[model samples]
Target: MKERETWKNGKEFLFSCIGVSVGLGNIWRFPYICYRNGGGAFLVPYFLFLAMVGIPQLLLQFSYPQYSSSGPAKAWVCCPLFKGIGYAMILTNSAVAIYYNVIIAWTLYYLVNCFTLHLPWSSCDNIWNTENCYSRTYGLASMTGNTSSYNTSIPEDQNLKTNVTLSSNDSKTATEEFWTYNVLQLTDGIETMGTLRWQLLLCNFSVCVIVFLCVFKGIKLSGKIMYVAATVPYLFLTILLVRGLTLDGALMGLRYYFIPRWAELLRPSVWFDAASQVMYSLGFGTADHIILASHNKFHHNMYRDAMIVPVVDAFTSLFSGCVIFVTLGYMSSTFQLDIDKVVTDGPGIAFMVFPEALSTLPFSQIWSTLFFLTLLMVGLDSRIVQVQVLTGSLGDLCPGLFRSRVSWTSAGVCLVAFVLGVPFVYQGGMYVLQLVDWYIASVAFLLIVLLESSVLAWLYGSHRLSEDIAVMIGYPIPKFWQVFWRFITPCCILVVWVMGLVKHKPVTFGGQAYPAWSVGVGWIISLVPLMPLIGNIILTLLKHEGNTMQRLQKSIKPLPEWTKNLRSDQNSEQNGDILL
Candidate 1:
């Protein structure tokens, strides 16, 4: 493996963590999730999830580096039988990274087109019409998100006249709108795959260059660059928020954002969804933060940084919600269009929405530049971490890729990433991303986390971790956090996972639900890690040795603290013989 490159300080380390953790998901998805679930009201459930789960889990992932002194590989060893969880994480990270760059390419394409004031995907025809022309965003060639549903829902398919009014109580929507669109729903998944479809290819090419250059120096330079790179999106977001709020429809978007239907909270699924959103928004288990943690040198107050990263992340989500709704509202009110029709676009929205929004401003061109640039930066923000995670994961998988010091060259990484990514350039690429997201975030991440926490909090012991942190910091993690790590966090995910399965109705947003077999196949699509975990269990049992505990301990090389004072004390007599 390449020599480990540690961080200069917590500030730089935290910044890079922020760079990855607070990416497009927060800026794009959160606003819409908030808006959809009841704007300001969404915050209630969101904060609830964070308080009950996200915050503690964030602290747990951060605390993990300190404990393992390893990346995902080392981190997974914290659990007894779940040692292979790290490998699953690495796989998930790398897969996500490839498509993530595809998104950045989307943002860049729009940015370039902004100069021309020709936003692709503005009119539904851009998508409905499969054309060779650049003006129509989401060219047929670009296989971005869910083209199957998207293919079926072309603007031409929607018979509603432009600016048609159909609703009695604001439920009116474009003829073929996907799930729900609000400020958050509208722009979160901006169509980088839209008009000027060539931009997706071009943008990926540029990002591949940037990744190679930035990462070539390894984490040392990457961390320093992150100090600036991470903060740029917020700067742009602030400008957009200011201008967007001042425009028409901005307040309406904000109204949708802040006002929540209390009834939504009553649904058990709502809280479950909020929990997923927290995981998705915070970048909890994607191995993104672990890479950052690996680069960071240990500190006495690493816990403080741990706490701060999530707070900053959540804050960005909150502020970003305002920025988006304001912009969406302005777009909605200005075009004299129904807000719902404008909400749930693929590329048709991104190219059309913001360009259309900026058109209303005094210097629409300049604002267009900032807005696209900000979108690009927001898109860029997420892309970098995906790269970092991929690099880290690949380094784990193929140590030969960088056994010693290796050149972080622009050319090599670009070629490799592009070649790997080109398959995604095909029609089914977006479907793959959805499958990966479900498996990785919903399954691998949560499943591993549930297992990890169970071992740490139950078997390994949270008190020991508390003492370890306390001894290091001269104070312990608050009892609130302690309870969280031990119980609350895992239970919350466990519930979500269970409910997601038990009540797992395969309802489609637009099309007919897939048959049971297809849905079953979808579940297995990304559950790659389960095979290894189950295999390990079987192998351990087949040994005919002792119990799971004995077989696991036998396999692992002992650390110096094997019989450390942590375990052999209070609870030893009960689980002692079983464990040792």
Candidate 2:
């Protein structure tokens, strides 16, 4: 048998974790979540959840891979029956990688356009623009109708008097038209898988190539690349922040972002949003962290690594939120619209609203290029980790097939992921992306975390896990963490899971409801990860040679390969000396 690979050093592992955790979710999703939940008031529950749930859960996940020296698929050696959790992680991450790359492709497309002296989205003259397209503008002219300079030939449906009365809401901004018409070429709804856009396909292909090159040599090359990928966003964010704050209405946006609405803290939905955001932002319940941490040396001080990474993630989110809302404030002031009018979530903010905001700045083309490049880096960094999780899990499972040709295995994984992502490049791809993001990414993640916390806390025993961590970190386990891992964290997760179930609504995009069958498909995507657990249970029951109870008990016992040291450590602890 061959030996498993380990990260070159502690710094490499830390950078890998940061690369995965601080992703598009932090930049695109966090700001909108904050805006919707309660502006600044949401931070109360968000930080609370971060302390009670996020940090503890991060520690648990980090411990598993570092201790076992195995990827998610092989990390669950402690309870072999729950090996399905590992498989679920792999499958969920694979599904995420598919649609996630499409977003990166979109960013890449925008990045390529930034090279032109005039941004394509800055004008309404393109074939994709409609008569209703108007550049984002300022002064009384934008509020009143002085759009004759924007629209060359007004439609005959409206006379000159009617045209003079038009408002900012009457027509789509150039950025909106560019996103809906030119970039996405979005179809009406999820039911229609319209013709594939060749440009997007090429862009998606290019993104796949970038991901492959980054990881083809495994952690050696990827760790070096992560040094740049993980650090560049902060530089871009700082530049954007400085520029955004200098714009008019910047203070108004900052007030909206930071001034707490204390009443929002009393709402159950706000707490739920806070919990979900922490999970998503930290990459919890996903295989990315587990697989990346699996490469750490046996005694790597992941306790410190876990602490540092989540803090960095939270800071990045707060920083990104400030940059986004400040720009939105500038946009709102420029267009004579409310700040809320310009603020949106997910791809809406990243692709449309922020681009519109960028157009109002001096050196608009340069700013536009920098903004999309930052996005491209953010998305690319996350995609690399997801791809690593998939390929790492496969390599761990079939060492003989992959250990000799790590680069080839990585290429194969990227190829398969690229093919899977093709559907998302179609006109209806955004709808599909929304569906996957909702069902697979959101619900499946909650379910996995609930199961993982329950198993580790109750069945595997939190005290034992804590002692193991203490040995590795050379410090006693904190009492607060013990309480969190054993009781508080799981209780909080259950509450969030129950709330998600109770508040569940049918998947929709831009107010368009999905057809029944399409909703069914979403459910199927959500359930696919759970199938491995069910299949594993039935196989164990059928194959084991013993009474039902005995066979089941035997199946759940720790595997001999990775758990020998763990068992020995436990035994030595009973003898008053724990082994690292």
Candidate 3:
């Protein structure tokens, strides 16, 4: 077999992992989840779950690739029956990648418009605006201290101190109209996939080209790019936070973000949301981190990398909350609305609320450009890593076909992913995006994480994994990690998954639930990725020449080659030839 490529140093691997961890979700998803769960009170469960669930699973994922010197799929030599765990990882990440770039395309379209003297979404006079459209900027400029005509019963004694007038019940802000009409060109339902939006198609194609160029040369070039792509978003966040703090109601938003609702800690859903957020923001149970660590030098300190990456991810999510809520707080104070009134869920916070907030700022065009640029960079960082995961996995699985042609592998994956993503740029694409994201990214992802934890900690053996980590890092894992890996993490994941399933509602957009047919399609999208696990089990049982129980026991045993490289390293360590 040809030698697998390794990173020049551990720093490259760390940065690559961090780039994937601190993705667009930290900016858009985490803040809203944080605020909704408990305002400031949510941190209790968030950090609790992070410690109990996130770090342990991260170590498990990190350890396998580092020890095996292979991608997620190929690393499963430890327990070949569970190799399907790796397949599930790849499929889930691939499903995410398909629709994710369309978001980057949306950001690209917005970034281009940011260069204009006047922002397109600033007024109601745009061609996309309807008779019900009311300009948020116009309202902001026209009514300073004037009381809003919109009916509200909240007393003036409240914390926000609402005094300004708001648009009526029927009014949609220019920001809203632009997002729904101009950018998305949204149809009423998923059944009506209208004509392609040529502008967005071109933008999505550009995203594909950019991703291809960055990754086609392999990790050396991409690793160098991470030096910038991984860290620059921090600079943008700091800038936005500083600017947001200066606004009148910025403190109000900050309070909403950090102030703990102690009572919320009693809610099962609050804890579940926190656990799920840790999984989402930290990029757990994904192939990208495995591929990233697989490139590290054999003796590199992944225990440290695992620790630092999750910390940075959590900090970025917290910092982004400051940036988002302060702007939200300002919007509330400006429009004399409560914080809850101003806040929105899902992508609305990114494409609508934040854009409207930026429009209210002085030098709105400059700020808008910076914000979308941040989104573009963060989204691109994640996209490159996802491509790396797919390409690297294919190379690992079929070295002969891809061994000398890594670039070709990358190009083909990017081309195929881009083509699949094209449907998202259609007029009704947002609906399809919502449907796929709801099913493919949610429950299926939880199941993948649960399966990995069980197989690695139980089936493959936690004590063995700890010994493997000690081999690479020069020390054994703490008892806490071992205990959590074998028991606590799995229990927490099961509770969260079950609770989420019980509370689950049909996926909806703009207050409208998807049709029954579309819901079925969503289920199929989620279920197809999980088929490998069942199929592999039946195959393993049939292939082994033994009784059912004996076959099951034999299937879980490590292959002879599983620790071949590790034994060589152990011998070298005993000879004092290998040093950590």
Candidate 4:
């Protein structure tokens, strides 16, 4: 067997874990989610779901690797039947890594444009702008946010509107136009991929190159890089917060962002959103954490690191929300628009909203550069770790083939991911990106996470695993945590998963639902991760020589090898010394 790699120090492991958790979503998605779900009131459910689902799953991700001495895909020695859970994680994360870089490409394209004396997206003067393109000023005169508006709250309504909608009658904002026409050069639908946007292709290639360099060798170098990669976004966010708070109407935006809507707590969707946000924020289901944490030493204190990473991830979301709302408020005040007109989530907040909002500032070029750079860093942080997860898992799964060939494995993964991402640079690629993201990252992800918890807490025995963690970390896992892992967490996940399926709507982009053929394609994409699990089940039943109950008992039984390292570490701890 090949020797597994370890981090030089715990800090690299911590930063890499942070990078995995905090990504583009923290900056562009969370603030809007919080605002829409009831602002300050949303935290109640968010943290509740975090405690119930996020933290328990996270501890498992961190501890499991140390227990097995393996990466995610190879860590299923205790229950080979559920080894598919690990493969499913790699598959889903690989699919995510493909389109995710396209987003980084978009950010890079905008970053390059930021060198201009005038912001390109700030007006309707570009060749890409059609007659329907309207600047922010077009509907500013009549816009208001009051009770008369639908879903309007003076400090509560996140989707506020007025007589003149921000984009209506087939109109688009300058920023929206730039995003659609210039940045994306979007086609009518997924059916018409239109032509390749060479500029975007170049940007995507650049991102692939950056990722390849950072992680090609292994975590030894990548771990050092993460020290800077993980923390630099915070610095930029702090700077933006200072500037945003000083802007006119910043207080109003903050008010709209943070004020509690007590009634929203009564709605089920708010809780759902909170739970989903926690999952999204920490990447509970992805196995990125498990793969990353596998690089830590056996005796490393993952419990402390796990808690720190999640707190930092949550804090970063709140901090980024403050900065986003501050600038959004400034935009609202300056343009006489409602807060709802300015608020948006997902890629829209970063691409359509912030570009325009930053353009209104004095040093538009500098601020634009700063903001996009921040996007680049955060996106890179997440992507590099994702790449590491893929490469490392492959090495662990096929050590005989890849143990000594890390660079080749990393190159192969990056090249394939880049090739897969080529379609996203096409004019119609945004539709495909959204479709893949909606299915692959949504329902299938939830299911994979659910399976992981069920397999560990029930099949492998949560109590035994907790004792293993105690041997490694020098503390027994709390009873509540075991309860959560065994009972509460699984129930909550099942409920949320059911709710998600029940509330499922056909995926749509802009205002148009995808064509039937494309929606069919989406369902196929959603099923990609589950294939491994199903196959493993059939193989387990077929290969294990026994009746149904006997086969089940044998499959869940831990292999003697699983105890080899655990016993060694326990012995070391029982003595006067522990392995460093």
lDDT of each: 0.60, 0.82, 0.83, 0.85
Error of 1 at 137 (Å): 18
Lowest lDDT 10-residue stretch of candidate 4: 153-162
Number of the candidate with higher TM-score, 1 or 3: 3
Ranking of all candidate structures by their lDDT, best first: 4, 3, 2, 1
TM-score of each: 0.78, 0.91, 0.93, 0.93
- List residue ranges in candidate 2 displaced over 4 A: 138-170, 564-580
Per-candidate RMSD vs. true structure? 8.9, 5.2, 7.0, 7.1
lDDT of 3 at 338: 86
Q: For candidate 4, write residues 548-579 as lDDT tens digits.
A: 99898888887787877777776777996758
Error of 3 at 133 (Å): 1.2
Report the error of model 4 at residue 302, Å: 0.7
Question: Candidates ranked by TM-score, best first?
Answer: 4, 3, 2, 1
What is candidate 2's lDDT per residue for 1-580, written digit by digit as tens? Answer: 4567777778888988898888888888899989888888999899999999999999999987777878888888877778888888888888888988888999999988888877887777665555556775521222332344323443433222223433456677778778977787666566666678899999999999999999998888999999999999899999999999899989999888888888888888899999989988888767888988888766679999889988899999999999998998888888889887888888899999998788766799888888888898888888999888877887888988886578998899999998999989987788888988888854667888888887887777788788778767778778678788889999998898888888989899888799999899999998899999778778867777889888878877767776654565577779998432
lDDT of 1 by residue, 1-580 (tens): 4555567667777788788777767766776666667556667878888878777776667665654446776555555355566666666666677777776665675566557544333332333322122221222233333323434553432222211322333322221232122111211121222222233556678878877777766677777788777888788888888888778778898887788688777767667768888877677556777767755544436678777877888999888778877887876776666767556433334455456556556766677788667667666656666666656655644566653433543345557777777644433344334444444454666776677666667656677767766644557667766788777888898887787677644423224343455456657755875666666656644654777776766554335433233343335546654211
Best by lDDT: 4
- Residue 385 displacement in candidate 3 (angstroms): 1.0
- The residue-level lDDT of candidate 4 at 457 comes to 94
Model 3 TM-score, 2 decimals = 0.93
